[model samples]
Target: MTAPSQVDYHDVLQVWREADTIPEIEHAWLFDHLMPIFGDPSGPAYEGWTLLSALAAQTRRLRLGLLVTSNRFRPPAMLAKIAATVDIVSGGRLDFGIGVGSRPSHPLARHEYEAHGLPFHDTAHAVGSLAEACTVIRRLWTEAEPFDFHGTYVQLTGAFGNPKPVQGPHPPILIGGRSAATLRVAAEHADLWNIPGGDIDDVVRRSALLDRYCTEIGRDPASITRSIHLQVSYDQPSITRDAIGEAIDAGFRHIVLGLPAPYPADVTRWVTDELIITSAYYDSPI
Candidate 1:
C-alpha cells in the first residue's frame, strides 16, 4: 500500500537573539512574527518589515511574514508600502497575516497598544481597525492602478502605488480571528483565514461558517484558503502527524506552527522529515 499522505513543509524564522546561522533552508519558511515586547526594551526597536528584508537576503526559498500584525501598529498606507517592499525583495514569497487584535498582554493586559497612545484596553476597536485595514490594503494592491482612497479612516488623493507587489494582484493576505465580522472580512477580502487555540469541533464549525459566508457573498468557498496556528515545541513524529491531521480534518490546507524558539536545528529537521510529506499529499489524490 502507498504510504500515508504528507503535509506541506515550512519553517518559522524567529530571532530570539542575534546569531549568524545558515542562510538558506530546505523548504519554504515564514519570517518570524515580531512582538514589540519580544526584544530589548531600552534598545532600538526593530520593525517587522525590516527584519523580513534582512531575512530575504539570508534565505532563498523561505517565505516571510509578520504571522499577524496588529492593525493599530501602523497606518494602512504605511503598512501597505512596507509589505510591498518586502514582497519585491523576497521575489513575491511574502505572505502577510494580519489581525485587528494583538498578542495577549504580559504582566499587564495591554502592553503594545497602550504604548502608542490608543485605547489598548478595548478589543472591539482592534477588530474594527483590522477590517478597515484589510479593505485599504486590498484597494492599494488591486486598485485600477493607484487611485484615490477616501475611506472614513483612511484618505489618499491621486496616489499611485509604486514598485507594486511582486505577486500578481498582491501577496496572499491571511486574516485571523473567528468573529462574525472577521469571518465576513475573510470571505470577502482575505486569501486565507487563521484561527488558533480552538478545539477540533470549534475549528470545523468555524470553517463551515466561513464557507457559508463565502457562498452568501457569491464567492466559491474553495477559493478562500483555510489555515491554523499551532504551538509545537518537541520534534516528535507523532506530534507532527497529529498536528497535520488535526488541521486537515478541520478543512485547513495551511498550517502555521509556532516555534518555541527561533530556528532550532531539531525543529527544522523535523519539518523536513515529516511536514514535507504533506505538500506531496496535497498534490496527489488520497
Candidate 2:
C-alpha cells in the first residue's frame, strides 16, 4: 500500500464529515463487469477504467483502483497505459488490482461470458494469460526502450508505454484470489494480495503457501502486503471490529469492508467513533 501523509485525527474526521465533498477515504475500488450478473442482471455497469479516470480526477487523497479488474476486460498494454495515466492524474494513488478471469462455474457468470462473447476458458488458460499479462505490463512500465513480447497468451512488438506512472516503477499491483494459480501470480508479481474474509488459521495456511511460492520464485514474501474483504452493513460493529482484529493478527494490513448498497450514515459515524477513533489510524472516508 502507498503510505499517505500523517494528518490530525480531527482532520480525518473532517474529511469523513464532508461525505459529499471528496470524502477522504484511504482507498476506493471498482469492479469489472459488462452487466450486473450478481444483482439486477440487466442493470448498468460502469466500465472500470473510464469511471476510475473520472474518480482519480475528482478525489485528492483517496487511492483509486479496481477491486479486481478481469484480464479478459482489456489488452495488457492498454490496461497498463490506462493505469499509468490514472496514477499520474491522481498524483500516484492507484492500487491497480488485476485477476485472471477464472470465475467459478455459475449460471450468471456463464451468461455474462456468452453475452459479451468473452471466452470462458478453463482455469489453466486463465492463469497462463494472467502471468503473461503481468509480465507484459511490468515490462512496459520499466523498460526505457521499446521491446517485443511473444508469450503463449500475449504477444506485442515494438511496444512502449509512455507517461509512466508517478509511482516509481509502477503503481501498486494488488492481486486477489485464493486459488493456487492466483496465489502463484501474487507471489511472483503482486505488491498486495487480497483474499476473502476467513479465520486466523485460514490466513496462516494461505500465507504459508504464498510464502513457499515466493521462495521458489526468489521473491521475498514479506514484500507483499496481505489484505482481505469483509462484508459490512450499518449495524455490524462487533462483526467489523472482530474481523479487523482477526485480519491484523493474521498479517493483513489492508481490510476492505464490502459495504452493501444503500450506504448508511450511522455506520460511518460508528466506524469513526469506535474503529477509527480507537485505532487512531488514517482511513479514507468513502
Candidate 3:
C-alpha cells in the first residue's frame, strides 16, 4: 500500500509495475486522501481512485485498489459506476475497498474534508451512511433493473448501473475500520475486513467482535476474510517480518504492507525478498 502523497506518479508506477512481476506480491494499493496527511502539510496528494485506475490499466496480474476508499468522498451510486469502470479497465482485478471517512480525532484527516468543501458529519452519521452506501453500491452492481432506494442516508430514484463490473456479483467488498459499528456493517456487506496493524491484541479483540456480529446476523463469520495493513520499515525488515508473523497468527491472511514515500530503488523487490519471503519462512512450521 502506498499513500499517494509526497510521491511522484512515476515512482508509484515503478513500484507497482515491479510488484506485478513478483508472484509473492499479490496486490498493490493506493490510499484515499485529498490532501497530504503526513510530511509537509501542503505536499501533493494525488486522488486515489484516479491513480488506481491508471495503475489498474498499467498492471495485469496484480489485484489492486485503494487501501480503502472514503465513502464520504463520492455519492454511492456514482462510486459504483466508477468502480465498475475500473473493474472493466483492470479486466476484473479490482478489490472494492471502502470505509466510513476519516475520524474526527485525526486532525490531519479532518482538514481534508473541510478543505474539499465536503461536510464532516458526526461518527454516527458517517457509519450509518457507510452502511447505506455499501448496500446501494452492491445493488447497483448486481441488480439488472433500475431501482429506487430510500434510506436514512441514501436516496436514489431510477438508479441503475450499466456496463456492470466485469467481476460477477461485483468485486470483492473489503471494508476497513476498527469501529464496532463499522464491523457490524462489514458483517452484512464486506467480503473482507481490514484494520491497521500495530496493536495485535486490539486486532484480535475486534475480529472476535466481528465474529459475534456475523453470528447475530446469521452469517458465517469465516465468510469474511481478515486483512491487516502493516507499515513497512525500510531500516528494519525484521520489525515488519515480526508484525507479519503476528498478523498471520491472528488469522489475517491478507496483509497489506504500507510503503512510505521516497520509495527506494527496487523497493518492491526488497519488500518481496526481505519481508514477504522471510515472513513466510518464519511462519512455516519448523
Candidate 4:
C-alpha cells in the first residue's frame, strides 16, 4: 500500500519497481483519500483509480487495489465501469476495495467533502449509502440486462455495465470497516474484508461477529477472506516482523502495508529478505 504525501509519481513508480523484485509481495495498494492527509493540504492529492490505471501498465506480477475508496466519490455504475476497465487493463488483477466515505469530524475530510459538493453526513447514513452502492455495483457487474436501481442515496434508470470484469462475475469486493451495519453488508456481499489497523483480540471478536452474520444470511463464513492494513513499514524491520507475526497468529493471510513514501528502494529488499521470505514456509491462513 502507498500513501502519496511526500512521494510523487516518480517515487511511486520506483516503489512499484522495487516491489516487483520481491516475489513474495502479492499485492500493492494506495490509500483512497481525496485531500492531502497528515496535515499537508498543499500536497498533491493523488486519486486512486488514476493511480491504479497508470500502474496497470507499469506492473505485471502483483495484484493491485486501493486500500478503500469512498462510495460518495463517484456514482456506483460509473465506478463499476471504471473497475471493470482497470481489471481488464491489468489482466484481471484487481481488488475493488471501498467503504462509506468517512467521518465528517476530520478537518481535511470535512473540507474535501463540502468543497467538492459531496455530502457531509453522519457515519450511519454513509454506511447505508455504501451498502446500496455496493448492491448497484455488483448488479452492474454481473447482470447481463439493464436494470433500475432505487436506493436511499442512489437512483438509476436502466443502468448497464457492459464488458464485465475479467475476474469472472466480479472482481473481489473488499469491504472496509468493522461496524455492525458494515459487517452485515460485508457478510452478505464482500469477497474480502479489511480491518484497517486494529488489535488482535478486537479483530478476533469481530471475525466471530462476521461469521455469525454470514451464517445468519445463509452464506458460508469461509467465503470471505480476511486482510489487515498494517501500520508497520519496511524501515522498521523488527517492528514490521513483530506486527506481521502477530497478525499471522491471529489468522490473517493477506497482510497489506503502506511503506512511508520516499524511503530508500532497498527497504523493499530488506523487508522481503526478512519477513516475507521467512513467512513463505508457513501454512496459509485461509
TM agreement with the true structure for every prediction: 0.77, 0.86, 0.97, 0.93
Candidate 4 residues 17-121, lDDT tens each?
A: 788666777888887777876756777878889888899878887788887888878888899999999999999999999988666666877788776788777
Best by TM-score: 3
**For residues 64-88, what per-residue lDDT tens digits would candidate 2 score against the true structure?**
6787888877889998998899999
Off by over 4 Å in 2: 1-25, 266-270, 279-286
Which tens-of-lDDT digit does each residue in 192-276 have in candidate 1?
7888845778888888999999999899999988877766546565665576677776677776655554345555545544554
Report the poorest 10 consecutive residues by lDDT, candidate 2: 1-10
Candidate 4: C-alpha lDDT: 0.81
Prediction RMSDs, each to the true structure: 7.2, 6.1, 2.0, 2.0
- Candidates in order have lDDT scores of 0.63, 0.73, 0.92, 0.81
- Model 3, which residues run further than 4 Å from truth? 280-286
- In angstroms, the error of model 4 at 205 is 1.6
- What local lDDT score does residue 4 receive in model 1, on the 0 to 100 scale? 9
**2 or 3, which is superior by TM-score?**
3
Q: Model 1: which residue pairs collide?
A: 6-277, 6-278, 7-277, 7-278, 7-279, 8-278, 8-279
Q: Write the per-residue lDDT of candidate 3 for residues 1-286, one digit (tens) a residue.
A: 9889999899999999998888888888898999988899988999999999999999999999888999999999999999999999999999999999888999999999998899999999999999999999999999999999999999999999999999998899999999999999999999999999989999999999999999998999999999999999999889998998898889988989999888998998898879876666444211
Q: Write the number of the candidate with greater TM-score, choosing between 3 and 4.
A: 3
